[model samples]
Target chain A: DVKVTQSSRYLVKRTGEKVFLECVQDMDHENMFWYRQDPGLGLRLIYFSYDVKMKEKGDIPEGYSVSREKKERFSLILESASTNQTSMYLCASTTAGANTGELFFGEGSRLTVL
Target chain B: GESVGLHLPTLSVQEGDNSIINCAYSNSASDYFIWYKQESGKGPQFIIDIRSNMDKRQGQRVTVLLNKTVKHLSLQIAATQPGDSAVYFCAETGSGNTGKLIFGQGTTLQVKP
Candidate 1:
């Protein structure tokens, strides 16, 4: 089975602190994505990478950035955490050119900024 | 801007009864749609998917129906069980090769025994 592993299941950080959320997928998929989920806003894409060292901003990428330094590793960065940034972050991946809309996702990391 | 939205925020059904969750999309160019189930504290799992070429598709106990005329989609679950209680989200493929998906706010399904 394909597994997407998130480094942190839960994290609490103070305001203005820099935070890193790491994700590693064992399937060697060509595409990786970062999304944030909130109560009424659903899952909004923060950023996505189709290749190593390449990234694209999504609809809600204002407060986030991403890095794909390796084929299997994708990281989400919060330069300065704030209370409004508190939410569940999800990592997902899929095979290249597979536009079938099926995404394998990690368990998700719940981040709380105080 | 393209967006996907749900008609209801929550749906309640009795066990053994059928449950239907509805979604609407504004992107007419979207050819692929998917339904996902997310339990408490877990990531969204793919339940079923339907392509624009087809209006209806079925899986083990779930059926997805697409209405291109109204740009609407629906997921029907047969014999809804307690284990099926979760938040259901419908997504449409965004226009691009990156395979980005626009998701709905989601509908919480509550099953009563």
Candidate 2:
């Protein structure tokens, strides 16, 4: 089975601290994505990468950046964490070919910024 | 500004009954539509998907209907069970985009015995 794993399931960080959330997929999918899910508002895309060293901004990309140095891993970086940024983050991966747009997602990382 | 939306915020159904969740999209160019089920404290799981060319598709006990004329989508779950309770969301994908999904707000489905 395909597995997408997040580095941390639960994280707590102080305000203004830099934070990193890591995700690794064993499926070797070429497309990976980062999304932040909030109550009432559904999952909003933050950043996505199609290939190593290639990235694109999604709907809500402010205060967030992404890094993809390898094919199986994608990292979400928070330059300066704040209380408003506290939410559950999800990581997903998909194949690059013309098959369609089906995505396999990790469990998720719940972050709390104090 | 393109967006996807749900008609109802919540729905309740008794076990053994059918439940339907509705979604609408503003982008007519969207070619792919997908339905996802998200349980509390978990990520969204793919349920079923339908392409623009087809108006209906089925999988397991779930069926997805697409109305291109109105840009509306619906997911129907047969014989709803307690284990089927979750928030249902519909996502629309652009014709040329690669796996970039625009999701609706979502509808909370409560199944009662």
Candidate 3:
């Protein structure tokens, strides 16, 4: 079975603080993604990594950055957390090949920036 | 920019009843579609997917129907249960890019027992 685990399920952070969300996948997929879910916006892609040290900006990549030092781990960094950044963050992974864009996702990290 | 969208924001159905959710996409280039169900406090879960070559696909008690001409997609759940109550979204994908998906606004399904 594919296991995508998130380090923290819940967190409460103060404004202007730095936040880090960690994700690890056991399937050895090459593609990793970070998305933030809001009420009306659904899930907006923040950043994605296709390979180690390679990253691309998604639709909404502002105020966020990502790291992919290894194939199995992907981390999302919030430079200065604010109330607007408070939302549920999701991590997903997929194999690096020609196929359907089926993404296996982790449970999600719910952050509350105060 | 072209985007995927849903016809309604919420749908309510009684237990054992059938439910249908509709979505429309403005981009004709999109050839692949997927349906996702997201329970409260969880990420989206893949329910079923349909390609442009095929008109329909079924999985368990769920069915996905695609209409390329109109750029419309629908998901039908038979014998709906409380477990099926969640926000359902449709995503569109095509060749050429990084395989990233463009998702619809989403529809909330409520099952009454």
Candidate 4:
């Protein structure tokens, strides 16, 4: 079974604080993604990386950035957290050239910004 | 703008009965579609998927139907149980091999005994 592990399951941060969410997948999947899940909005992609040091903006990328320093590790960064940024963050990955549209997701990290 | 949407925000059904969830997509180029189930406090899990070349597909107790003419998609769950209660989301792959998926607002399924 493939496992995508998130560094934090729950986090609380004040406005203007920097936040970092880390994810690592055991499988050697080449693609990784960061998404924020909210009520009524479902899951909105923040950023995605197809290779190390390569990143692309998704539908909602205004308040987020991502880093893929290593193949298995992908990180999401919030330069300055805000109340509106409070939501559940999910990390997902799939094998390279996989067109099946199946993504293995992590358990998700719930972040609360005060 | 191209997007995927659900017909209902929630669906309630009695246990042992069949449940159906509907979805619509605006992009005609989308060829692959998927249905996911998200339990409370967990990430979405892949339930079933259908390709444009095929109109229907089944897995275990779940069946996915695609109607390209109407651009509609539906998931049917047989013998619904309490454990099947969760938020269901429909997603379509983006234009290319980008592996990006556009998801619809999920529909929450409630099972009654």
Q: Which lDDT tens digits does candidate 3 get at residues A1-114?
A: 888999999999999999999999999899999988888877888999999999999999999999999999999999999899999999999898654568888999999999
Candidates 3 and 4, the one with greater TM-score: 4
Give the root-mean-square deviation of each candidate in angstroms.
0.9, 1.1, 1.3, 0.9
Candidate 1 deviant stretches above 4 angstroms = none
Candidate 4 per-residue lDDT over residues A14-113, each given as its tens digit: 9999999999999999999999999998899999999999999999899888999999999999999999999999999988885657899999999999
Q: Write the per-residue lDDT of candidate 1 for residues A26-99, one digit (tens) a residue.
A: 99899999999999999999999999999999888987889999999999999999999999999999988856
List clashing residue pairs in candidate 2.
Answer: none
Per residue, candidate 2 scores C-alpha lDDT tens digits across A1-114 of 889999999999999999999999999799999999887888899999999999999989999999999999999999999999999999999989653557888989999999
Per-residue lDDT tens digits for candidate 4, residues B3-108, read 8999999999999999999999999889999999999988899998988999999999999999999999999999999999999999999577677899999999
Flag clash pairs in model 3: none
- Quote each prediction's TM-score: 0.98, 0.97, 0.96, 0.98
User: Number of backbone collisions per candidate, in order?
Assistant: 0, 0, 0, 0
**Cα lDDT tens digits for candidate 3, B2-113:** 6889999999999999999999998887778899889987778888998889999999999999988898899999999999999999988744566788888899999999
Candidate 4 displacement at residue A103 in angstroms: 0.3
Each model's lDDT:
0.94, 0.92, 0.90, 0.94
For residue A32, what is the lDDT in candidate 3?
93
- What is every candidate's C-alpha DockQ against the true complex, given to 2 decimals? 0.78, 0.62, 0.62, 0.77
B-chain TM-score, every candidate? 0.98, 0.96, 0.96, 0.98
Residue A18, model 4, lDDT: 95
Off by over 4 Å in 2: none
